[model samples]
Target: MPALQTINVSKSYGNFKALDKVSIEVGKQSIFGLLGPNGAGKTTLLRIINMISVMDEGKVLLNGKPVKQSDIRNIGYLPEERGLYKKMKVGEQAIYLARLKGLGKQEAIKGLKEWFEKFDITSWWNKKVEELSKGMQQKIQFIATVLHQPDLLIFDEPFSGFDPINVNLLKDEILKLREKGATIIFSTHNMASVEELCDHIALIDNSKTILSGEINEVKQRFKDNVFEVSYRSLSPLSLPAGHFEQVETQQQNGVFVSKIRLLNGNKPNDLLQQL
Candidate 1:
């Protein structure tokens, strides 16, 4: 069964429609990518799921049951906008947020410590949020979000404001969370990250769902049947006919590289035999 499912969900604000009959199913323990351009209603859909806003139409289910107010405890959300209290100490803020997620004081502190240690942020515990760098604050926010170990995790623009190394570190942690049985909904403009991490994706455009499917299947559907072949050759050679309809050859790093687009299902072996 899906970890989360939305059926014909829609949301509107005044005369503006933010989401139009958006439906999606997120499988258990999977990384589901929510992708779209700016002003495409991605944030509106996320707000509905987080219960920050009400949907104008349709319903949402979590683990096959209708979503309820109490179900908020089962979700960990990191919004695109950072919400840290600048005057508060990192540790205190983290604990408070975790408590809001239904964790006991003892559990929240213990879990926060473990996560801080894991992320190498233990030294930042007593520091005021304003004293930390943006990336450091983001780390604290991330710690707060996951400290309660909710079953579902939602991250919006998770890599924003982080350097490349930290971005990769966060990506690794996200994968780890999935392996540990958390269902993740990742909303971002980073198509490269989606290509790397998403098992499935749904793309929203103009407040409507324009695309949705398993990542590999979607990529395959978009494939142009192009292939690149590299081989070692000392001299230039005439190309074989059956290898491709059009072959572009180049010399790179002492090797002959060729990009081939097959014609009429021609096999690579047929070209190799002629060479």
Candidate 2:
């Protein structure tokens, strides 16, 4: 069974429909990207999965069993919005959150210390959350989210407020989480990150799923039948009109290179034979 499945789950806020019968299956130990533009119901779905908000209709299943309220302890969620107690010390708050996730006080302390060291934030242990920079606080939230070692991990734009170096570090950690048998539901607007990290993706638009599948399969299915060719034709390159549609043309090192889209469901072999 898939690690997570949403069965036509839906939600609406009065006149505004946030999610419309959205269903998704996330395989275990894989990165499932939830992508959409603003107001595409991505956040609403995440809230439902995290059990922070109830779905108006449908249900969520974890490992083929109906997800119960108690299942929240099995999932760790880092939302897009940052929330922290400004007056509380960084380490103290992290341990508090970890304990809320079912860790003992001592266990939470030990785990938070290890994570603080890994994130190079050990120096900020006693500092109040309000004293840390936005990026530093975000790092703290991230550490708190995963410290419980939950079965499912959900990150909504987890890379926010991070530099390129820190982003790479977090990405590596996310992949490591997958290796350790965690199911990750990753939501992001960065298409490059999706390409780099996601094994499968579902694109939601207008409160509905518009596209979904394995990353490479989706790309291949959506690609135009265009091929770039640089051939030495004895005469100036000319093709029968309607046989090949030139999408782009350029001269590279005195060689004529043209990008042509095969016409009428024709394959590259047909174009090569004519060339």
The most accurate candidate by TM-score is: 2
Query: Model 1 over residues 144-216: C-alpha lDDT tens digits?
Result: 7777888999999888899999989988998898899999999987778657899999999988998899999
> For all candidates, what are the clash counts?
0, 0
Off-target runs (Cα >4 Å) in candidate 1 are: 227-263, 267-275
TM-score against truth, every candidate: 0.86, 0.88
Model 2 regions more than 4 Å off: 227-240, 248-259, 264-275
What does candidate 2's lDDT look like per residue over 143-175, in tens digits? Answer: 988999999999998887889898998988888
**Looking at candidate 2, what is the lDDT of residue 211?**
88
Q: What is the lDDT of candidate 2?
A: 0.89
lDDT, candidate 1, equals 0.87
